[model samples]
Target: MIPISVVVVVLGGWSVLYLADTILKSFNSLKNSYENWLALHGLSIAPFHLRWQTSFFNRVFYKFTERSFKEIFQKFSVGMVFGVIAMFGSMILLAKTLMQTLAQMMEEAPSVQSDHVLQVVSSSSRIFTSRSILLSLKHTQVVVPGINLPVSQLAYFFLAILISGVIHEIGHGVAAIREQVRFNGFGMFIFVVYPGAFVDLLTTHLQLISPVQQLRIFCAG
Candidate 1:
């Protein structure tokens, strides 16, 4: 039998997807209606409605690594080094911020004894976990945060995933153009506000394209 906790998590995730689709639809409808109203008033519509045009490369480096990652890195050693450094930095910063916040809060509270405050601070993680465990009781509250989080992460990790994901999809589309394969615009998936880039090889997939070519295009993304 599937565990109840696991079932709740899965259903909660699906609800978040539904919420994102609704949000995107509403935004698009509003933009179109507003643009039509502006046309009636003789005001030109604003340019650059692109909320997702984030590019990752500065031409030179992008072309430099156009070849296989194996060719660029020669091995996975450099990537491994970068991954370790990023993780260590994130952990240290998070720990320092958490500690400073807790200390400041304790200093402002004179009625709470230092020992008692320390005990509560140490158990904060336990309290957070318990709150999450109780999430099934208010499923929408749990799901909305899950839905809206990736959009928030995109703002901060813009340098990391947004650029990379865009470049990755563009590389696929460029490859298809090079191979003379029929293609469509780049595909996209917008979840709540969390967007993802995808390659549009729908016709290629249906047609009997060589597995090797498909593999190359897929890997570009």
Candidate 2:
């Protein structure tokens, strides 16, 4: 097998790619207003945007959204930190081990296609083709290539991480909207390969009309 991480990383990675691809492919075909909104701040979605990668799944999961965001984040963040440690040897070990994989995946990945044309190249996610920070997960490697293994182990691993992240950010947005605070924006980020969903806390703070509203948004994400 190609290794467990490979399958999942590819699947998760490509899922984002495919989603972006579909959205981009349909951009011209989409109605003006909707498409325009995406284009206007689409660049802001950089570094992380995997929520759509699991949107339907996220939608169904949120029905169980009775928990506060801070509580959930604290619990899951601790769990993920531990899980990554157990699976990848506290990141340090994983880093030492996957140096080769990193080299290869990157070498194989399209890293040099960036050639700007007019104003378009400077303004778009499709141009970069960088591995999504959200999909760049490490840990749960059940195989070793020539050794043969599947990345399926990382599927659930990533699903949890991804879903947790999506819920975290969306919860922030929902809480903010529900509280009638401004929506400066939210963004995605990556620390190593694990993904993180973060809301614009500073802007959120400024936009919040009151402590109760701020508390609502803060507690949610």
The best candidate by lDDT is 2
Candidate 1 clashes between residue pairs 3 or more apart in a chain or in different chains: 20-192
lDDT (Cα, tens digit) per residue for candidate 1, span 77-149: 3433554577798786666555555555555667457447766655765543332233223322222332544
lDDT of each: 0.49, 0.50
Where model 1 places Cα greater than 4 Å from the true spot, the runs are 1-154, 187-189, 204-206
What would the TM-scores of all predictions be?
0.33, 0.32
lDDT of 2 by residue, 1-221 (tens): 45566558656875686577567646666646555665564332333343312223333334334445456545444544555446555565565445435434554556453222212323443433443431244343534423442355644665677679867777676565444454445555554345666554347444647754555555554
Model 1 steric clash total: 1
| Candidate 1 displacement at residue 60 in angstroms | 17
| Candidate 1 TM-score versus the reference | 0.33
Name the regions of candidate 2 deviating beyond 4 angstroms: 1-41, 44-152, 185-191, 199-208
